[model samples]
Target: MTKIVVDPITRIEGHLRIEAEVAGGRVTDAWSSSTMFRGIETILKGRDPRDAWYVTQRFCGVCTTVHSIASIRAVENALKIAIPSNAELIRNIIIGIQNVQDHVIHFYHLHALDWVDITSGLTADPAKTAALAASISDWPLNSPTYFKEVQDKVKAFVAKGRLGPFANAYWGHPAYKLPPEANLMATAHYLEALEWQKDVIKIHAILGSKNPHPQTFLVGGMAIPIDPDSQNALNADKLAEIKRLLTKAGEFVEKVYIPDLLAVASFYKEWAGIGGGVGNFLSFGEFPQQGGGQPWLPAGVVLNRDLGKALPVDHRKVTEYVDHSWYEYSGGAGKGLHPWEGESEGKYSGPKPPFQHLDTSGKYSWVKAPRYEDQPMEVGPLARLLVAYAAGHKPVQDAVNGVLGKLSVGPEALFSTLGRTAARGIDCLLIAREMPKWNDQLMDNIGKGDYAIHNGEKWDPDRWPAEASGYGMHEAPRGALGHWIRIRDQKILNYQAVVPSTWNASPRDAKGVRGPYEAALIGTPLADPGKPLEILRIIHSFDPCLACAVHLLDARGNETLKVAVR
Candidate 1:
């Protein structure tokens, strides 16, 4: 078996590494690792519980909003404080918009290159690309003239001898199956998405404060005081602006993002059988309705690729193992502890820098293996949709079935890499459609003079129980994100976060069970082991969130790649 290591896997906010063993042109084994150490859990200790949300937002610059929400939810859960109806509606809108924007960015910017060969677009006929784009959707920019201009813009970038965002990829690789026209069409949408994301995320700025860590999150509720008559608060003009932004964002998702996803997926139906790992999925359930009603996306567990029934998820059954991870537990290595009692510390056990393969037999990665009922499970958009579909959610059922019908595949086909990619679009569309309704609901509540956002019932520490503990779960854009906290004397005593990537990108456990990334790669075929584009396809499909991008290293521990950022 020949071993291949991909350190720093993703192009943005990525710090993961994968080591795979190839034999007979297919992967036979794999190990997943994280090159970065996270100390947020330790940093949060002994701090004011109310301010934890602000500090936890630093977990990831890109996923800042989700972390903020998750942290606040944890503190509120611990204090048994329920936010008011207006606060719930506002939070729901922000969460929904965040997921939609992330899904769009993941499809067009991050994962598309694994399928689309941007360099090949230079050889495409702009007119033919226009035809292809028009055939997919009635997006206004489908004119042949617009495509030619887009083609010219790409050609000019290459003329500069640097591809800018399009650099350092395995362009013209054998694994890229899309024709030149499709590649060109996808490239056009990619540029459009860069602009599209910026405009849509203004919802964050208007509602909270700004993007990449909105400042409105609080332990009891949001800091945004809702008052229509007050210009400084959520006034009539700001409300109108929010509604308009969401409406435009929805239009883009429906016309451009969803169309591009479906178009790109058509040529890769075979992927419906590739990279289906662990076959156990988890979702924390997201977008709860006002007044503690059912969440728009209910949480459940699907085991063994079973779509017929979704077992109810009990957060208590969630456990983490550190035997194969870099950290050790007080209970001993390989022991499973739920987040309420979770303990972690930075312990670097891998070989020093400039070293060859990791000591995979022992502790290798910084990511801890999270299990549901002692079983490793995959999380994120696919898991959320699968759980919701199994629970007979009509909208999710219809959206998933619609995609399956368009692709001419059965429900079983949804268990692959391509399906995972497609689920994000389905989830995006559903949430995009629902965002306007949420905005309208908020507006209606404001008209009814319900300006209460914070409950403030248990906001005071003087009324506190000496010790309290609770966990918060949010189905962030990538997957199920959970934060557990223990509060004592109005200060944090213990804190732990088992994020989505921790579940999917974890290494192994005492039983030698591979995490989702490692398991998914076990049977992946590599057309050329030296250039493993197939590996990128599978990993990108997971939508990994780690550190930032960097160059690759050869198996001999040589920095064989050098990339320039514009």
Candidate 2:
């Protein structure tokens, strides 16, 4: 057996690394060591719980709104505060818009090249590509002339030795299965998506006061006020503008993104049998209904890949283990602690710097293993749709069944790597359609002269219990994101954020159970050991964000371990 290491597996900004043991051109065992510490939870200690939403947003630049939402919700959950219907609508619109945007970005820019051969796209006939694009969707840009223009631009970039984002890829790898024409079509949309995403995120700027990290999140409710006549708040003009932008975003998802996903997936159907890891799924359901009941998406768990029985989620069953991680729990190394009792003390015992292998025999990674009912489960778009579908959510059922019919595959196919990718597209389509409805709801609330954006009933800390603990959850673009907090004396006592990547990218636990990333790679067939693009397809499908995984940690000013992949 030979060990292959892929350090910083991300396309641009990377923090996760996978070292696989390959035998007979297939992965046998894997160890995923990823580290990027923000120490945000530690910083929140003694700080005002209400202010955590702002500080936690800095956990990662791309995950700005996710952390902020989770933090505020945790504080509110502890205080038993209910936000107004207006605030709920506004938050839903922002989150839905971001989810739609993030999914599109993942497919076109981040995960596409793994399936599309950029060099092959240059060889495609523009006329044939245009025909292919037109057959898939009636997107107006599907013209021979337009495809020709896109081809010429890419040709110029390659001629100048500046491939930009297209650099660093295994251009002609055998694993890329798209035909030149299909590749050309996807490449064209790749450029178009770049322009489309920028415009759609303006929804955030209008209501959020800024993009990346929105400033409107408050513990009790949203900080942005609503008034039909005011220029400084959510007004009639702003509401109209939001609906218009969301409508256009929906069009892009249906016409360009969904069609492209199906096209790419048709060529890789065998993947439905591969990378089916753990066979357990979790979702902290999102897109809540008014009056705060079960979220529209439905929160549930599916164990052993059994879709027939969708289990209800009990937050008390969630626990984290640091057996293979860098931190040490006060109870014992092998002890599993719920987030409220979680600790993040950093202890480095592996080779310091200039080390090759991670010595997997001991604690090797900074990411802790999160388990539900003592079982490691996968989380993200695929998990969300699976749970929702199993729970009899009609819209999700229709969407998943529609995609399964299009692909001519059974529900069992949804367990693979490509299935995970397709689930993202389906999730995007459903939420994209819901964005306009949310905007309309906010508009209706405004028309009724009931523009309450906040519920400050528990804003002051004076009406506090001596001790309280609560957890917040959000079905982020990546997966189930949660923030657990304990408030005492109006200040944060112990805070922990068990982010999506931490759950998906977790290392092995005390019982030697591998996390989703590690398990998914166990049987992946690597076409080439030196250039293991297949392994990447599986890892990127999880959308590993190490910055979010290695969060809530305090290294205590220890010397940063010099990271080396061998």
Give the per-residue Cα lDDT of candidate 2 at 493: 91
Candidate maximizing TM-score: 2
In the range 292-331, model 2's lDDT, one tens digit per residue, is: 7889899999999998978998888999999998877878
User: Which residue pairs in candidate 1 have backbone atoms (N, alpha carbon, C) closer than 3 angstroms, thus clashing?
Assistant: 13-547, 14-547, 15-547, 380-479
lDDT of 1 by residue, 462-540 (tens): 9889999988899999999999999888789999888889899888987899999999988999999988889989999
**lDDT of each model, Cα atoms only?**
0.87, 0.89
Question: Can you give the TM-score per candidate against the true fold?
Answer: 0.96, 0.97
lDDT of 2 at 342: 83
Prediction 1 TM-score vs. true: 0.96
In candidate 1 the C-alpha lDDT for residue 489 amounts to 82
In model 1, where do residues sit more than 4 Å from their true spots?
A: 547-566
Best by lDDT: 2
